[model samples]
Target: MTDQRQDAIPDAIPGAVPHTRGVRFAVYSAHAKAIDLCLFDGENETRLPLNRTATDLFALHVAGLKPGARYGFRAQGVYDPDRGLWFDPSKLLVDPYARELDRPFRHDARLSTFGVDTASLVPKAIVTEDRPVAPAAPRLPKGGLIYEVAVRPFTLLHPKVPAALRGTVAALAHPAVIAHLKRIGVDAVELLPITAWIDERHLPPLGLSNGWGYNPVAMMALDPRLVPGGMAELAATVATLHENGIGVILDLVFNHSGESDRHGATLSMRGLDNLTYYRHVPGAPGLLVNDTGTGNTLACDHPVVRRLILDTLRHFVRQAGIDGFRFDLGTILGRSPQGFSRESETLRAILSDPLLADRVMIAEPWDIGPGGYQLGQFPPPFLEWNDRARDDIRLYWRGDGWKTGRLAHALAGSSEIFSAHGLGETRSVNFLAAHDGFTLMDLVSYSHKHNEANGEDNRDGHNDNHSWNNGVEGETRDPAIRDSRRRDVQALLGTLFATRGTLMLTAGDEGGRSQQGNNNAYAQDNALTWLDWTTLDDDLVTHTARLARLRRRFDVFSESAFFTGQDGDVLWLNEQGKPMTTADWEQPDRQQLTMLLKTRDREEDRATRLAVVFNRSHDALAVHLPGGPWQDLFTKDHVFSPVLPPRTVIWLRELADPSARDKEAGES
Candidate 1:
């Protein structure tokens, strides 16, 4: 077929756009000699060569081609792999801007082989018509809780969820799911990667599949498996969440694509323009920069890549009304050959863009590259995952020495790290556990990672988890061991909730979901990873709910400002109720401490003081209070005897007394 192009067509906008006459298909490939728009009609294939309308763009307008048409691209160019050129006309390429995929990507050896016709192997990109949803502001509160969720595993075995909607994005809108989120007081749900992804080439050989959708191929296309209804389903789910006072934050992976290393699949970007889409060694174009530990890192500094990322973000915001985004391996976004910078062009663009300015931006601020651990370096308006807090909290609860100061630092919003620029509020997304590591229950039940099922010989996950088994490792029938583990989990949860800054809870962690001690259960898509809602620990769920309510009810728990010891804003006290001196903080075996804070009781609309006592010892400790008329924050019982249970965190609030009320006000 002869090339056809119209000067009126906007070549700058890459992707298939349906218009009055037909569909306008455009793709960007700086190095391709020629590109073909391969249309699929059942078993028949029609190849139409595209005209090089722009310097680096191919464009064509095909009449009668409508929205629901399945198509792929094939580029005919130099086929040198050593010099970073992988143009093979036999390989079918998905559109970089594809909004929908006809099927999920299936990896095969032929996909990476040269001269292999992969029209049947690769998933076809479907031409879709855009239906923009009404724009709305983000719904995440400043210090709200973000519940990290993997779509399929979260609802796959949920007894209340419908069978048909068990593992789909549409199921998130179901009343059962929403009720669970509301019960745990999840202000926002950070859905893990829902984009179309191919299994790691190594997985299918081992009879395993990628349960976590971290490996992405199509950046914009919603996975036909996870999101069956495409953009419409996601948009509707977001609307439903917004109606229930919860927000939706997509956990996006832009650091790398599923194309993997040089031996990886010849997918869309790699075939279209490998040299342009990915970062390569300066002297050796064939050598890719493995910054993300995911084969190849995206050349995010490139103009083409920057535009694609921005366009993708805008599309989600405009079409789905998405509230925010949590960037996985986020350091890659601001990295260049010179290393990472907070003022990178892409970071600036996302911050300056009118449409994205108000959205919540969170960064998983680390990768495997040089200078990748940029914990507190992200600029304002971008909250970062604080691994420091996670490790310190775990170490403290594991009966480590001299961790009291570290725990205090984390609980107070980690001022030393976040306050370097003199910022009053912390930009930390504090959490005890996340999707990448052990669940909350496992943190107190497993001493070491039990990833035997991952086929990697248990060397995949974190080595030093800073975890401890109460008495016995793994699951035990001993009631004492079980009760000890439960108490430790509750204490950890209480510590997380009482900490200052934004909070994040992995889905099912509130109700004690375990991965059989497998910290890296990314490949176990079966019952091992699925959350068994029927057998969830109801008492733990209740404890989590109460913690959530306490966090919301007391303005102190949500305060963004850093606490100062002056004026009773905050005080670290010993078990004797006196200000903790250096000797007390340095006590290696001391596991009991009190955190006193001046706060406002929102329920009573009165200013009151709160004391959070933590005891990690095996024996209950008697603690003295400086103030009178203290009551249990959750139980509402007067603190007749100030004694903390073993491995427990007790919250005590000063009761309102007419006699001492005015004196307390005067002192403040």
Candidate 2:
């Protein structure tokens, strides 16, 4: 007899597909005894049995079924949770390949109980026809800045955004949003997850929700709540961003699903093939592996799981015109039974794929699993988020002793960390603050975390923030304290822009947005997290814009190669105008230093040198330089001054020739 798998359908792909006559549905399950397809139409349900076309494959073709049809699966088999078999015919399972969900997935207590009919509680997958977008190269420059944005919070309070368009993907394309992005010199916007996700079981009782979108259920489906227009909304938004020269990168959570521990809901993958989709303990099959702190981890090394991940990525790139992806808890992607490996098959496949080869790939590079911190270990072309830079930068500004060298190392792209892997250039994405922690304004305003608002009783965020309040904690009316905090914020922005490698700035960090010391504000969807455009410090905004302009006008700031300390590429100087000796660098109380670089002025088109001076002392310090014809980039002062302000960072450029001086004079 001929093979039934090949004879059933010729080169059939999984999920529901609409063709001329009708729609064909395919699902995969390694342990299910039988599976049935359930179609829904206005409170009426129809069940159709699917034939086992191939090993671990169940498929069926329903005549006259078209797009927008709502459907789900029900698998029949052993109902033993301890042995990793969770098949229940009464529970309506969502198709793993679902590209669109009829509605958002809501948490219900009956979802986990066996033999409980839950067709009403689960979201039915809607059949969608793919509208392919023409392939385009990612627009972000190698060392350009990436602005991290949480869509809803970023646009919810914007005055220019229409009330109806606010809190949706379409709002990102608004002129106000795009104009703000342009002012900050943003090359791309790294949006937090827009995929459909269910709130954590503990959130509903507390009257809070997961605003960060880290917990995802369907890999391919866009959350209906965030994108009501579904794929079309996202596609059009991307096209609009591209029109104004901004790329979009999605922050995806492949490490774990919204499905929590054993008691968690079995929405889709857990109900269809628990053993195959999720990772379980070696000897104890019933016990799930909690690599990600959220709950059970994905079995990324498995062939079926790898194919799903690849298809999901391809779907985003081909259908929605996404430029790139940032993998949350990315170590799990290279993880297996042995451990996390840099040479994992899934990582290699993504790098080699035709459609995805040139796309940007970023990794968080760490998880909570055994040996999970894999910083600087991802293969080439993958940039890793540099927590080392974040901590060291904070420490230096907090007046920690013996951190001058550490600060210098971070400013130079943390070569000590990335160079160990024999890489020629740095792959570090440097930032002082991110979505998971306190904002830049809060970093200097609150010395300790005040997480009482998170419902965790002040126990949710990081304790040692390496932060210091100028004089008062939280908000204050004292002008002295306010001025001190503003200077600190400006110094932090200057230091970040002066650093080598790619840069990232969380949404409102440049203009003094804060979460009131709630470092972990993942659950605060209210005004606490929204960007208050009206109350922004205009001085701080101008300073940030100037810094961005300097970074763009100077060639050295965007260079990715490690400085060799030769050919005037880099120099570290002390207060005495001499090269930093061993004793000077070893001083615990060292608060003043200078970094000199040989660079070219992009606009002037001439070779010049730049000096970035740092003063952390409480009093103004007189600093000496080894050059003449120096002009302060910010103050536009042609005359050189030896006195540097306390807790300030100044950029001084060495005028190359008479022509350059004349040009500067003409502009002034």
Write the residue-wise lDDT of candidate 1 on 1-668 in tens digits: 22334466664479999987899999998899899999999968999988876456788889988999999999999999899999999999999999999999998999999999999899999999989988787888867999999999998888888899989999999999999899989999999999999999999999999989999999899998899999999999999999999999999989999999999999899999999999999999999999998899999999999999999999999999999999999999999999999999999999999999999999999999999999988888899999999999999889878559999999999999998666778999999999888889999999999999989988898988999988889999999999999999999999999999999999989989999899988888999889899989999999999999988888986777888788789999998999999988888888798999888889998788888899989898998988667888768566646778899998888876634876786799
Backbone clash pairs for candidate 2 read none
Q: Per-residue CA lDDT of candidate 2, range 557-590, in tens?
A: 7789999997669999999878999888888789
Model 2 TM-score, 2 decimals: 0.97
Kindly give the stretch of ten consecutive residues in candidate 2 with the minimal lDDT sum.
Answer: 1-10
TM-score of each: 0.97, 0.97
Q: lDDT for model 1, on a 0 to 1 scale? A: 0.91
lDDT of 1 at 298: 97
Query: In model 2, where do residues sit more than 4 Å from their true spots?
Result: 1-6, 658-668
Candidate 1 residue 329 Cα shift, in angstroms, is 0.6
* Backbone clashes under 3 angstroms, per model: 0, 0
Q: Report each candidate's C-alpha RMSD, comma-separated, in the order given.
A: 1.9, 3.3
Which consecutive 10 residues in model 1 have the weakest lDDT in total? 1-10
